[model samples]
Target: MSISRRTVLGGLAAAPALAALAACGGSGGGGTTEITYGYIPDFNGASLLAIADDRGLWEENGLKATLQTFTNGPLQIQALGTGDLDFGYIGPGAMWLPASGKAKVLTVNGVGQADRVIAQPGIDSLEALAGKKVAIPEGTSGDMIVQLALQSAGMSLEDVEKVAMDPSTVVSAFSSGQVDAAGIWYPMIDNIKQQVPDLVELAQNSDFADVMQFPNVMVTSATYPEENEATTLAVLKVLRAAMDVRAEDLDTTVELTAKLTQQDAEAVAADASNGQYYTAAELDALVGDGTVETWLTAMNEYFEENGKIEGETVAPADYFTFDLFTEAGK
Candidate 1:
């Protein structure tokens, strides 16, 4: 669960190797439908992978799913852009960056809540971060969450000394009193709070309703979905089954997630039942109402206003295609 800073930084350099692994064929038997799946080793994706592997859902669906691990979303997107991955779980923000023509990928199904943000002890207000160093991985969901949280307090990134650090480093920074706060996700967030008993969650996705629903989405290369719609549908079917499994059996789901995240089973169960997982119906509504698009546009506008876009405009819809999910629904 504790990833080293060196590993996080190494991802940028290991993009080629990760992409190569993603491009490799599945390990299933002869004539089986092979589909590569890329995921970060987090609680959310880990749960799904555990269930799919344990329950043999992929095999049951005739899908030889090859689960590939990536260090972060950017690298995952990079591999996805190169046709290295057929499908993967990634943050919507990561999809937004590449959807601007930097990468060739499309969103399939929205998976879980964006329950990640800045946690600081005794920082009852965002103003507390003013002049204090706050840690975040640049150009990531955590970064965006921190930005939006600051905006909610009528403040901006300029209010704090932004420390561009990965999730792993954030913990060490906070532990050493080198940073005032860290924008991070579960397992890390839970782990940090436990270590620093005084640490408090300052901001989270729930703080911003519009952005809160920005779930982790299942994505694939544009070409794969275009040329292999059936296969894409089949994959969705497997995911849908996994979702159902999660809903029907909470204890089992939590145990599997714990095994994958290497966290306590009780803690994992608490997080699982914590309203992070989304139902298929809820995901459908998000897609139908252009909720994802609107959220992306808002994020794009934020990036642009903050001068992160750098003389370029990104179209949100370009990063997503509800066709596969729609087909699966039918």
Candidate 2:
């Protein structure tokens, strides 16, 4: 279950190579900081950082950054665990691991009701869902959301056959008729519906879950941040710049994500609307006001309650920090 760097790299060959790590640092001295930043290709949390990469903001800040896309947060976190990644955009499941002790949350990337349970056509109700297979990404927030919707229908997860796989694989599995139902996120939901026009929505995550956030949090190896303070500040500044665009020019934001991911622009827009976007000042308040902490603590409890992780829980503040944002502003 513990994924080593070699184990993860074989699956994610698109990422920057090990040779690339030797070249990290500012370009001012004939060497640019070589950073491998990872994110999911899904519509929600990656747009801002993609915008930054597209705009050459990382380079402008004197860093040679490679933005690698992954299947899910845990894959990226696995890369982080082996030091293959200097920074990563992670979800709640992966975040819990790093948030506890391995990595540090630089800032919450994006938050929203980003999960949904989509079923094959003519299967309109939960009653139809029983005995059918429900595919979801193992250990991610979408897994929990799917379970909540099943519970709302008066059914436990045991009532149905649960299939655990990567969300990306589930999408392909659904299209191939390998799965009867799939718990997925937009634009995957949107993408699947386009491919299989008869798919039906069994439940919307927004209806049953109060604080279900498909958060892509920016994080670094815990020691990496402390050792490279200036570099961390620079990275955050570029990210802060990208998020500023999400706040100011959302249409352009959607267009960029759609173009880069080859997803529908409308689906991207719909997903973006479900969440609250953050600016630098707003991030300060979210962290300072304890809003971020409360959300993370809830995630930890929910995961623990579900038996995903078996251990004592730590405070949310243990996993998150606002120092880079604070220093970026100054």
Candidate 3:
């Protein structure tokens, strides 16, 4: 699914003018840059925005960035594609879908190796899920991971019924035994386990460290980097600084994220700690053929084989460009 430059530019032009207006404003001068960012509710989004606002990281880099919170990654990616969001923090699955000629990736934020597969009490293994029902938010990264985990265990979707449920409902589903297993992220994993003492961890991203790194990335439209490379690079610099501060001061980072998400500081800290922060070099290593692009290529193949999309076999490079991150790293 290699969208032509004409198609991408046309898509950008077709988007409402208000979306472009919402994405950027102001001129860079005296070391000041203004960019609009789209974010979601989790610790990753909250903490990144908090660090930029509280620690003055954005301002320090002459950036006056404002964040608009989105409900989910797909929405954020949509906004990014429409030119309403200069940058966004989203899951690998989100990146894969749109980046397959549907959207593009600007940069990597942090890798998320923390997806959890929570099961009811007495169900300790993937085999135990056979003939039982599972719950997951359909068409999300969590869902894709759950599917992969099942396949790795020699099971298929037909072996068990899947109930499409939100993350918040996972606990109730488990408590009432509506679903035998739930694939979700923390602190939702933590929250569910707290409510159901018998809840067990069947598998998690950490278990599949060799196969994939669930990267939570900061991506933007393809036109953004070309039209506003300087501003885009400036934003990434600010984000990199924020990541450094967060890695060093976990307590403050957690507190600030907690304030933003209205969750407990400990819970936020737990989530932050589980994520692997990326330095410029770390990001480079992660994306070096073995990471994001490789994973996306596989996913696209899987989707095509499974008839998820029509004749759209997209290469990973079609959806992402490492040049901007490379420049920003310098």
Best by lDDT: 2
lDDT of 1 by residue, 41-81 (tens): 55554566677777877766667766676766656656777
Question: What order do you get sorting by lDDT, best first?
Answer: 2, 3, 1
Q: Write candidate 3's Cα lDDT for 60-147 as tens digits.
A: 6666766776655666667777877777766665655554565567666676766777788888899888988899766555676788
TM-score against native, each model: 0.80, 0.78, 0.82
Candidate 3 regions off by >4 Å? Answer: 1-32, 288-292, 295-313
* Model 1 clash tally, residue pairs: 0
**In candidate 2, where is summed lDDT lowest over 10 consecutive residues?**
1-10
- Residue 60 of model 3, lDDT score: 61
Q: Residue 96 of model 2: what lDDT?
A: 66
